[model samples]
Every structure is written in structure tokens, then in C-alpha cells.
Target: MAKSKKKQQTGPDIRAFFDSMDALASEKGLGKDEIMEIFRGSLITSYQRKYGPDARIEVTLDSETPAIGVSVHKQIVEEVEDPSLEITVAEAKKHREDAAAGEELVIEEEPFAFSRIGATNVRHIFFQRLKEQEREIIYNEFSHKEGELITGQFLRWRDREVVYVDLGRAEGVLPRREQIPRERFHPGDRIKAVIKSVELRREKSRDPGPYILLSRAAPEFVRRLFEQEIPEIYDGVVEIMDIVRDAGFRSKLLVRSNRSDVDPVGACVGIKGVRIQSIVRELGNERIDIVNYSPEPAELIANAISPARVAEVRADSGTKEALVLVPDDQLRLAQGPDNKNVKLAARLTGFRLIVKSLTQFGEEMSSPEARAQLEQLFSPKTEEGAGEDGDYTPLTELPGLSGRLISLLEQSGVKSVEDLVELEPEELEALEGIGKTTATQILKILEDVVSFEEV
Candidate 1:
């Protein structure tokens, strides 16, 4: 009756112990078997620490019975050699009948009591192992997330420099260098950043983390934002060729479409600029220029300089250099603040860009070096004033044409008399900065230079 009463009394305590173990596994994001193995190792360490180091101990945890049982193992010998490892057969038979020499006997260790120090040591080891496992879990989870955009709550800044964000299971560190200079965040605010890297701490410290390093200033951050906000990019209908960023100031992306029906730039911009506006607001209203990818270097360079009209792009395939001519009014705009626009365009297009106005290029053409460059540029193709069959003359080389008219024509994708002749007088007047007088002057210049034959 007393044995039955004692068993009933301790049943709930064992069930409670297993329940807490399950809770710990869930809290630490560890498997139940992993927790049990860690607990078993801790028990062995604590038992060896309390008794002699030579003690042979085994821990058995039964989930079906919801019980934890500890045992001491000993070799049954005719004569005892070591008190901890070997026991006399006479003594072994007391626990197990028919115990023979050279056989091993396992004795159930009931009422397994730990000293105060032993209990503390076991607790420390158990939690430390749990922490290490948790760190590994977090590391594996976030490692694949590198170069991906993630949203987290701003916790606090460490040392007033590094911003710490709580990412649920892990903490992300955004150093001051990776933050956009113009952006600010308050505590408890939701902040979005890209995972720059996953780093493991080597030092034995209180915080054992495979830390997630985050960034808002990286070019990859902008790339990820575009992928997230643009459905075509995500679905592979439109592909991003390259991304370059001056981080909080500006960014440029070169994109192309695989399908003929889809326009890459128009798709990224969305109707009325709704899609790109979301990405811009996410980036703290950073300037974003989505350039259409072109195999022709001249067209690509012209498209790269956006919001600022390009009058002409003369690209040399050999030297990977380009001369970008913009109108006088668009010179400053093309160069952008601190020349970020041109610099980013150069980086994106893989060209050394020399941005110039029409007057500036014309004045430089008077120099011998500029003249030699111009001659070499057109030598293999056609000579000056060579507008014969299947040949074209540059509008700049045409006589009696003002620089403004030449620049306006070039800005409208008309580089030579061949391209100009294709446009009607009405089409010429429809161009920006061109009215009835300018259109009449352009047509008169074309007529005087070329002998037109009626078909």
C-alpha cells in the first residue's frame, strides 16, 4: 500500500519534468532527442564530478513511461580489481540472479542525489550546450538568407554606433558604415535591411552568436528590393543585368526582358509609377534610374543617363570608352549632384564616360587631339560629307546647321542624314524644343546639303 501511494505521489512530478523538458526544446528550437542527449551528457558529467572521475554512469530517459532513470555499470569479477569499475560476483548476484564472472551488471541508481555544486554544474553545462545548439540553428537558418531583404524591429543602438535589430530568433547588427546616411530609425520601429553576411563569433563570451550582419547601403540591398517589389523581375520575365548604388543618394539598375511583348523599363515603372514608388519610399526616397539593357554600347550609354537627355553617344568598342554629349541646359543635370549620375552610369555600362555639351564638343574638335579622335572614329566607316548611297553624314559635319539644331536632332535619335531623312517635317516639329521655325530651318539645311531624287 505504501509503495503504491509513493508511486502515485511521484508520477505527476516525473510528468511535469518531461513536460518542462519539452517546453525547453520548443523554446530553444531544438529537437526532443537532442535535448535528451544533452541532458544525458550533463548527468554523466555531474555524476563523475560528484563521485570519482573513474565512475561509469549511464542515463536512460523513457518517454513512454515519462521517466528518467540513472544507472551505474560495473564488471562482475570473481575478485574485485577496481571498486568503481569491477564488483565481486557475490555482490552482483545480489542485484541480478545467476551473475557470472566477466559479465557486466547494471545497477539501478535510485534516489540519485546531487550535491549543491553538482546540481549547479549540471545546470550550467545543460544550458550552455542548449545555447550552442541554438546558435547553430540560428546560423544555419540565416546563412541562406544572406543577400535577402528582411524586416525587423529596431531594438537599440549599441555604443551609439551599431544598430541592433531583433529578428525574432536572432539579432542582426547593422554597423554605422552600412546604414544610409540620411535615414534614421527610432526604437521599436520596423526597419528593413539586407543580410550582408553570417558570421560566427570565435571568442568564448556570454553572447555566443553566429551574428547576422545587415546593411541598408549595399548595392545588393537595392537589388533585393527590386526583386521583392517588381513581379516581373521575380518571375524571370524581366532580368536585372546589373545594379549600382550611391546608396542613400541614388541607384541605377540595368534590366532587360526575355519576352518580346514585355517592356522591361515600363514593367519596372508600373502604371503611373506605382510599383517603383514603393521601392523608392522603402529606400527613403532614394533616386532610382532603371535603364533598359541594350547590346549596342551607344544606346545603352544613352539610356543609362536618365532624366537628363543625351544628345549623342559615341562609343569605341576597342577602348571601352564613350563620349556622351548632352544639351547645354542638361549638362548640370546629366552630371548630377557631385557627379553621382554619370559615375553610376559609367559603372553600369562598363565605359569611361566623358560627358560634354554640344558647344563644348565642337570647341574641343578644333584641337588636334579631338580632331584626330574624330577622324579615327569615322575613318573606317565613312569620311566627312560622304552621304552617297548606303552612306550617311553626321549632322555635326553638315554645313549651315546650328549647334542647337544638331543637338536637338541628335537627342531625338537622329545621328546622321540617313536617320534625319526618315523623319517628316511634321515629325521634326513634334520634337521637344523644336517649333515651326526650327523645323523649317532643319528641312532647309537637309535640302541644301543633299541632292534629292524623286522616285
Candidate 2:
């Protein structure tokens, strides 16, 4: 049997480019017209770079075909001072019957037809622009997905054991530290992760491109998983108040339901515990506690220490401090081994919590000094010299702060007055250009300036 002859491909190869452009536009959600406009500019740029930018040029696309045409508009003069940009009235009349001196003459031409270097420049411009447009399309697509759950294909592992997942349009990196230890990914496996951030990452001598940093270990990842699993959470019926997790180990999820009849915890738990069980399996059997959220901090703290009986809780809203009392035998359970239970509760509640047995609470209350110390703890810790809202003050707005001090503060990552408040005198002295005397001066100026404002 004779082999079928392959038909020879012919016509302006530029048509193939337009076809490819459409395909990429469809896939990347890019505008075809915008890309073609960029390509036209690039062609003109390549022509200018090669042919001394003396001639004014206009580029137009043929309506009937994919071919691009270039026209050099030259001044029709009596004498051609520069052949590239000026044409004699006699030469202009060859294209136009009534061409006259001082009139503009249009010379229809193709770019890079005469020089090899010009052709090479055009080729380079095409590829460079193509790469840039691709980067922009990817960045625009993924930037909107920051802090969102995305499904991706597992590609391969790279430096530091980070897994690169193909997120359809862009690649996302799941750093080893941000990956769940209990989970493993294989090539072609469908994996789900949360996009922690989208940022431009540059390597040596390479164009910076936006990359997605993904995570499965973040607390938000578990929250997103619950959002995916439970319809009530996805809709407006239920809301997640807070979530805290120790990836691949345990997680605490607090939820509230809008409807009085619906239990937020039960909605997440599902019938026969199927909903939470599915999420637990996805997390490699990580234990999840679905709890009802209470606006009251004491009640919330009490709920957080569930499975362990709490006798009472005293919470001060101002100081964000809390003291929990449990029965003597239940104290160990409330605190758990290594104080893991109380620590998780504190993180979830955003409260400084102290877990004590009922007996210890009574004994502490029995002493006058101890009682006085507890009262002090209940009051807000006052900043000695800083403004109550110094955190809102920019470094440049601080009184008595010199340009040199501002530069140093910027270098040390202290951009505002609040950052300075976080540092001790010793820590301030540890800065590159700061001495003990300078540290003391900075503190004194801060105190005096903020105090004067108050007065």
C-alpha cells in the first residue's frame, strides 16, 4: 500500500500565528485584539531598532487576511534630503497622480525584508512579547485567587522538597513546610490546596514571573475544606467564626448559624457524622472538633475546654485576659498533657488564659497580694510613653525623628511609631547605627512627644 502524501503547507505563515493567538486567547482568557495590537507595536519597534528611527511608520492589518502591512509616511519635498523619510515630488507622483510638494507620501513596505539582523530582531521581539503577555495573563488569572481553594494536578517536586502543582494556567508551589506530613502527592494525582499568596518571584538574570504559593497546612486550608464540604457554610446560613489547626493532628472549628433552629456544629458534623468524617479522612484522619460559637468570651472559653468540666470562667474584655477554674480532678484534662488543650483554646479565643484547679483559685483569692496582682492583670497594660494609638502614626509623622533615624527605622523594618514601641532600649541599641545614648534619646523623644500631644 502506498503511503499517503502529506500536503505541503503554503500561504502567509502569519495566518498560523493568528490561529495560535486565538487558541491561546481562548485558553488564557486574554483578549485577542489586545494581543494583536501589542504585536503590531512590537513589529514597529523591531523595525525602528534595526532601521534607525528616522521614518514615521504606520502599521495596519488587512481586513481580508491575517497579513500585517507597514507604510512609511514621508514628506513629499522638491528635493529628497533623506531618502528614508523624504521623497521628491516627482517620485511621489509615481504612486499618486496629483502628488505635490509639501504633501505627505505613503510608501507601502514589509518590515525586515532587506536585512538579516532586522529579521532576527523581529523574531526576538515576537518571542519576548509572547512570553510577557503569557506572564501577564497568568498573573491576572491567579492574583484574584489568593486566599482561595484551588484544585491542581501534582507535577513534581523541586528544591527543598517543594511540590509544584499545575494550577491549570499557572504553577503553584507547596513548600515543604506548608505541606501536610501525612499526605503525599504523585504525578497526575489531583490535589487540592489553598493559595496563600500570589507574588512575583525572580531568579538571577531571568524575567520575574508571578507564582502562586500554596499551602495545605494553613488553618485557612481546613476552613476552606469545611466550606467545600458543608453547603450551609458555603451559603449564608452558617458562618465560621474561627478556626485553628495543628495540621495532620487536630483542629478546632467554631461556627455560628443564622437560623435559631439550626445547630451550627451539627450542620458541620452532618447526619451520622458523615460530613466531618469526610473532611477528617481528607486530612489524613486529623481530629476536628466542631463547636458552637458564643459572643461571650467566658462562654466561648468554656466551650473550647469541652470534654473537660469547667467550674467557672472570669474574663476581662479590656485586658483580653481570662482565668478558668476546673474541678481538681478535671484540671489535668482541661490543660491536657504539655498544656496542649489550654494552648489551643487560647489561640482560638485570642485570650490570655490561665487554667487552674478550683482549689488553687480559692487559695490565690485568699492572699491579699495575690488578689491585688490579679486586679492589676485585669486592667490594660498601659504604654508608659507611647500614644494609645501610636500604631497608626507613620515614621515620618513622628516629632523629632530625623531623616537619618527614619532611614534606619525603614531598614530595620520599623515603619511606624508602633514598631518602635515593640522594641526595648537594649533592642534599639542593637540596631546597626544605634548606640546606648541614641537609644535612650529615641525613647525620651517618643515619650515627650506623645505626652505633649496628650496634654
Candidate 3:
């Protein structure tokens, strides 16, 4: 039987192609050293694909210039049998006179002609490898930057749903779901977008930088804009407690001052609304209402529903609910065109807000039929001591309630947790040593505490 021979796959030597060092460095923001390393690794991979997998190869790339060289490493032998892997001592000595039988010899040469179809394939393979490298670099950069702000040029539109941005070293996508529906970003316009996500793409995405996802609609974007536009917020004198947006048309920002003298809302709005105006322009003239954040839930919610003064706000701690009273004329503004304002205010304040006109609030307060309706609308099974629950725990059992708070509760004749739940926020604040902070904390504690028996 004849000995079977192994077939070898060879490709065109694309090393002859010159890739401008400046072009590569500019594309990835990589220095010459990094580019050379990438080139060497790419050559080794290309060489292995062209030659057999077991073929021994050594590749070198010029660190200071765009030059690459590859060599096949073969052992010097007294009598060569496999010419591809072994060189006769006499033949090795022709190049390196010190060559010995056991020593290795490196022959500098191109494995295939540059004009061969294999060369084109090798070039394509090399560039594809570079693309993967670039993907890794950009992915690493954006992954740590998710939710961070990035400014780039609007590249183009795609499918009428996505916008592409040219971030110097990588491309980013503004998916339709992340775009502001009311804001139009034109080609070549400069944009500042928030990094929504960064991941290694498995399937081909519609735009470049398939691994990058940017967002203009994220609430974080509005927060970032506020941070960028407001000097006091950036300086930490004013803090943004929370922000909620209707995405395109409007946004609500809750800001509070750390110092007693600095007005958070005033600082955010700047003198005559200059700072917020800059942010509003960036958001395509989106209406932004900067409201003061208070430790008091009712006050915060009342403020969140700006342009509509609240006659009174009644909050239920255990239910995490609030009743918002507005003048009949302001009811439309409080609830917006379709309850949009109240809905956003609820989100910003973390409450289930019930908005109503003052007349309606009064009717419920004074009318018997209205009282029954209110009872039906807001009624829930109350705990036993108050007459509706089978199980109950004392207010002292509230978690994280300091001894001082418990002492105050006990002194106030609050024997059971149910009794504490019935006190309004102002009543809680009025207790000795229970300031606004302690009152807020107490309300939160009660909101989540279930009776020991129920637990």
C-alpha cells in the first residue's frame, strides 16, 4: 500500500500590503507598539490558516514602522527527508555557518505569492481579525461606561428607527426605543448620548459598533444633563434626588440643597433659567420643571406637581398612597393632558398619587355620600387593634427605629403599631426629637413593617 500524504493549505502572502500606520493608529487610538503587537498576532493566525496547523512559524513586526516579516522555523538535519520541516546541515550552513544537526534554522520568505487568490483571502482574514480586535477594545471602553455620557456626531439614519453616532474610536447606536420621539437628530449634528449598554454582539446589528447601545430617552440622560448643566449640582451643593421624564416632551427633576441657604431649584434653573434652558435646548426644547425635593413626602409630591399648587396633601404611609388637592382650575395642569403630570410626579416621588380638585376634596371631607365613596375607594383590611385585622404588632417592633423614636412613640400614647400608622406625617414630625428626617424614616419603616404574627 502507498503511504498517504497530508494535504497542505496555503494562502497568498498579504504581508506585501502596506497599511498606513497613521490610519490604523487613528482608527483605534492605538500607539505604534500596540498596532505592531496586533499585526504580529494577526500574521501568526494567518500563517497557521495558510500552512498546516502543526507548522512552526515565527513572526516579527516593526514596532516603529509599518513593516512585517515571517519565518518558517525548521530543524537542521544531517539528511533531510521532510523538506517542509527539516533542512540538511549543508543547506543550513549555506545561510548560517554555525548550524548544527539539532539546531533550528529560520528561513525568511513569503509562503505564497501576493497575486494569488489566497492573498486576497488572507487580507480579508487579517482585516476581519483586526475588526474583532477593535470590537474588544471598544467593548471594554463602553462596558465600564454604561450609563455614562458620551458626545458624538450623528452619522446617519437607518430603517427610520435607529440613529448612528460616530464616537471617534467606535460607532454607537441610538435604537428607536432609546430615541426621543419628539426630538429629531439630523445628520452631522453633534449629540450627547448616554451609554445604555455594552455587550459582545452575537448576531449582526443594524448599525455599526454592534456591541454598543446608546440612549437619549433613558431617565439617566436627563439626570446627566442636569448634572452637566447645573454648576451647583456638579459642585455637590445641590443634589438631584430623582428625575423622571416623559422622554420627548417633558421631564421632572427633584433637587434638594445640602446647605440651608442654597436653593436647589434656583441653582438648577440658574439666573432667569439659563442653566436649565441650556439643558432644555439640548433636549430639543423639552419642558423641564425643576422642583424642590423635601424630606416630607406630601411636600415633595406637591412640589413635583408644579405649576399646580396643592391645597393639601394627605399621605398614607402603610399604603404608600397620597391624596393631592388642587384648585379646580389647576386640576388640568396638575394631571396634564391625560394624567401625564400626576403620573410622572408619582414616579418621581415614589407614590401612588390621587389628584383631585379642591372642591372634590372638600366634598369627600364634608359629604356623607362622598365619604362612603372615599371609604370604598381607599379601604383595605386594617390590622386588628384598629378593628380590621386579626394580627398586630406594637410600633416599637418597627425595624431600625431608634430607642429615641420608640420612646417618643410610647410617650405619644402609641401603644400599638396600628396607632402609629394612623398618625399623619405632620403628627409624627411633631413628636419630640423626631424632626423631618426621623419622621421620614419612621414613615418608611411603617410602610414595610408587617405585624410579627403576620411575619
The best candidate in terms of TM-score: 1
Each model's backbone clash number: 0, 0, 4
Q: How good is model 3 by TM-score?
A: 0.68
Q: Rate the local accuracy (lDDT) of all candidates.
A: 0.81, 0.77, 0.74
10 residues in a row with least lDDT, candidate 1: 1-10
Residue 395 in model 1: lDDT: 77
Q: Model 2, range 1-455, lDDT digits (tens) per residue?
A: 11112223234676776787678667756688876777687777876654357767778764246566776677888987776687787777776778888778666665535388777777778767777777877888888888899999998977648888888768888888898885778889888889998876553433267778899999999989988999999996898988887677678888889999888988999889987887887788877877679989999999887658899999988767788889999988787654667767878898867788888878878999878767766655567743434314687777788999989877988877856764657779999888898888899988877531101
Rank candidates by lDDT, best first: 1, 2, 3
TM-score-based ranking, best first?
A: 1, 2, 3
Task: Measure candidate 1: CA RMSD.
Answer: 16.0
lDDT of 3 by residue, 1-455 (tens): 11112223232333333346547767777776676666666667667665456567777554334345677777888887776577788888776777788887776655343457657766676677667777778788779998899999999888877888999878888888898886677878998999988888743653444468899888899988877877788889998877888877679988789999998878888778777777887887878898887778888888989978888888765667777888888888888854678778877888877788877677657978767755644556456534423233565567888777788888877766756755668778888778899889888877677432111
Compared with the true structure, what per-residue lDDT tens digits does model 1 show for residues 1-455? 00001111247777887899999998888889999899998888777765457879878787768667777778888888678788897887787777788888877654335667767888998988777778888899999988889999999977778898999998899989899986778977999999999977754853457888999999999888888988899999999999998888889999999999999999999999999998899888999999999999999999999979999998987656678899989988898875668878988999867788888888878899878866654455445644343334677777888898888888878888756765667778998889898889888887888643110
TM agreement with the true structure for every prediction: 0.73, 0.70, 0.68
- Predicted structure 1, TM vs. truth: 0.73
Cα RMSDs of all predictions?
Answer: 16.0, 10.7, 13.4
Clashes of 3: 4
